[model samples]
Target: MAVYTEPTDEELATLLNAWGLDGLRNFKGIAEGIQNSNFLIEVRQGRFILTIYEKSVVLDDLPFYLGLTETAANAGLPAARPIRTQDGEMVQMIRGKPTSLCTFLDGVSSQHPPSSQTRAAGAALAQLHLALADYPQKRPNDLGPHNWSELWAGRAAHSEDLEPGIAPSIDQDLKEFAANWPRDLPRGIIHADLFPDNVLFLGDRVNGLIDFYFACEDFLAYDLAVMLNAWCFEANGREFDLVKGRALIMGYETVRPLSQSERNALPLLARGAALRFFLTRLVDWVTPMDGALVRKKDPRDYAARLAFHRNARSAADYGAPE
Candidate 1:
């Protein structure tokens, strides 16, 4: 749930004046995202998703993510374009939190991804990776490979606190994974978080990618690895729809094919991606935070995914790449 900090119509009108978007209009809260508060701004001329960056998004990195959208749009990829305020900036401040408006994207998320939609999603994601090439900004990767290990080492020690106990041999599993996992693969910009909610769809085609709050400088394959975990796995701990997975990989490879090194590293990176989400979920489960309108995504939701990666050795474990 997207939280809207209560701003009276008068206050918002004043805000528009301050931002030079005056001749402004009405606005209503958008109840969707868990990380930020969003409002649908209805000005006399147009509409936009007014996002108030909640705590999860660091204000300083706003430009990088926003600039990424600009870059993606330039690449002919689908995504929201930021509207400039009177000061000619893409971001602004409202009540201490960074607030900005982006064109309201249409469509809904595809939970049971169709093959065509999956292919389109794959193509767009690949385009995003291509467009992100040579970009000269770096943001802290909250879910980098190293961070995954550190989190496991740190949190494993506190198993008593983490609800899912140290499954008797959790540490051993972690150690074995660390030792056997492949490394030194392709690296670059990654959408560390690409869950269903972050994407939009129309029928079967992906309309746009949203929430680059977790974008970072990491292995490009890592992003694909993230998607494998997201789009391929199903609700009952089953991995279905190999064609969907292939569509994604095919679309991505159409733009930039994975090297042998990246190919070899996919399993481990996929494991790393699974663990990253697991720890975040575990952490959230252990200590639920407050006052955020968005519902915390379940931590245990990715357990089966981690288990699959745990048993993986090559891309074949993910299913034969198309």
Candidate 2:
């Protein structure tokens, strides 16, 4: 259902032929992602994922995204490497959109992953950071705190309609972030969006870390904060799960430990992460794109998260050790 532009069978076969791949047995659209149109492709060589870059993706930034994943995959992480064509090009044009194919990883994403799996995901993310530590390319975090005001500008009424009286809190959050955002922390390339759905797991071990569209250079602890906001919250987003929080931080530290400064900045970083998601979701809710097959996410889910982050006193509040 997420296939915004369906390639004809002949077109798909032609695309595969260019890669020296033939006998395309089956290809079906994957419904999990919202940024790009993805298909589960099966050919004679193996199973793969073909992604059609949506308008939301910047064509020039494709190389940075794909190359980062390649770096992670080559470093023995469970990342899906981009498959190049016979001409050695990692991307091709299909239906006038940039497209790339990657080896399909075998595993399922959990909607409600347990603490054990959450721990594994945390460790895997740390491994990804270590793997890409020396990766030379740089791309700014387009959705970081710097862009929150622009994203939320003139959308106050829309936000208030969704959840009455919520606009002022969001305004105050942006103001607080402007004044108090961390200036010094360990900086590196981060996965940026390691939500549960982005990680594929097999029995508490990560099999694949897919979706590198949001990867960028930023404070590494901010990446951990993103995961904490994502993986440590209950479904309602109101209740923070202490056991999962402990497991996630413990797992990541086993691979790469966080600095005291990073730990101290966790609360604010988590709050900023929550606001980023909220603003993006609010944009989608207020402005529905035609022909885009994305199910608009509600902003209130993150609003609840923001409220919790607003009150959190320190890393210990999030179950991180002293």
Candidate 3:
């Protein structure tokens, strides 16, 4: 449960009315995202996801993300398009924070090994890369791992009120890695967070991708690396279906093939991706934010995942797809 913002049902309905999107028959908070207070709102036989942006959201960059989704939607990709108010503004100030409504995306989130849904999720992610390839909009890539680590690491190290288990050394390690990780590779719009929770599936197919707040401009390979961290691994700290990796890469390659150089960079890229999540999780552990209703993700969990990458010889080292 992410609590980036909290609004009562009455407050939400009032906000909807203020924006001319009223007539809400029902609504409830969505329990998945950790960055915003989200809800699935119902009205006129349709559903929508409403978010009240929190202090964490960069107000000026809101247009870049919201605009990306709108452009990606035009490109035939599955992502939420921010609906405009009657006045035609994409984002409106609500309750002193940025708030907006999106057409409720269809499908459920994949939690573990992807069950029967990995291939389609893989294919759709590729499609997303293809769709956003030509959109002319550009913004700084602000949500990569290094920034995530820096966001919490500073507060964690300075906090003396947190639990003893929260180690501050992760901040140093993450900073070192960020300073030295490889750059100079293929760059494009990366969906910086494509975890199972962020990807939605219908039946055996991927129907939508959510959580664009972390989206940015980075190496396309880095996007694939994020998928390998979230989709291709197991919960008990082991590698399972490696084809999830193949399906994802193959699907993306169908639209844009990886150069030999890109392929060679993936292992190191995956290590960088792994360390990114580990560092963020560790920072949150040391300095949990006050009034945050969301459950803090375990940084140690990713630290353990990093160990698996340490042993990875190649994507093939995990076993090929059937």
Count clashes in each candidate, considering only residues at least 3 apart in sequence or on different chains.
Answer: 4, 0, 1
Considering only N, C-alpha and C atoms within 3 Å, which residue pairs clash in candidate 1?
Answer: 1-294, 2-32, 187-219, 188-218
Q: Which candidate is the best by TM-score?
A: 2
Score each candidate by Cα lDDT: 0.74, 0.90, 0.71
- lDDT per residue for candidate 2 within 1-322, as digits (tens), equals 4667788878888889888887778889988566688999998899999998988788899999999988998999988889999999989998779999988998889999999998999899889889999989999998999999999999999988988988999899999999999998888999999999999988888999998989999999899999998999998689999999999999999999999888999999999999999999998888857756556777898989999999999999999988
Write candidate 3's Cα lDDT for 1-322 as tens digits: 6555678667776667755775678777777555677878888747888887877788888888898888877777778878887788888776788888888888887677453476676667777777888867676566565576556545554333433433444455466556856677778787888888887777777778887888888888888888877877777445645666776666666667777777766776777787777656666676657755557776655666666766676656433232
> Model 1, range 1-322, lDDT digits (tens) per residue?
6464766667677667755564556678877777787888877657778888878787889999998887777777778888877778888787788888787778898767776776777777777888888777887677665566666665664454443554444565567666865556566787778766688998877787998878998778888888888887776444645677677778777777888777788777777777778777777766656755436666566666777777777776665473
Quote each prediction's TM-score: 0.89, 0.95, 0.82
The pairs that clash in candidate 3 are 1-294
Error of 1 at 292 (Å): 8.7
Range of the 10 consecutive residues with the lowest summed lDDT in candidate 1: 160-169
Of 1 and 2, the candidate ahead on lDDT is 2
Report how far off residue 74 is in candidate 3 (Å).
1.5
Candidate 1 residue spans exceeding 4 A from truth: 2-4, 18-26, 157-170, 176-183, 291-294
The order of the candidates by TM-score, greatest first, is 2, 1, 3
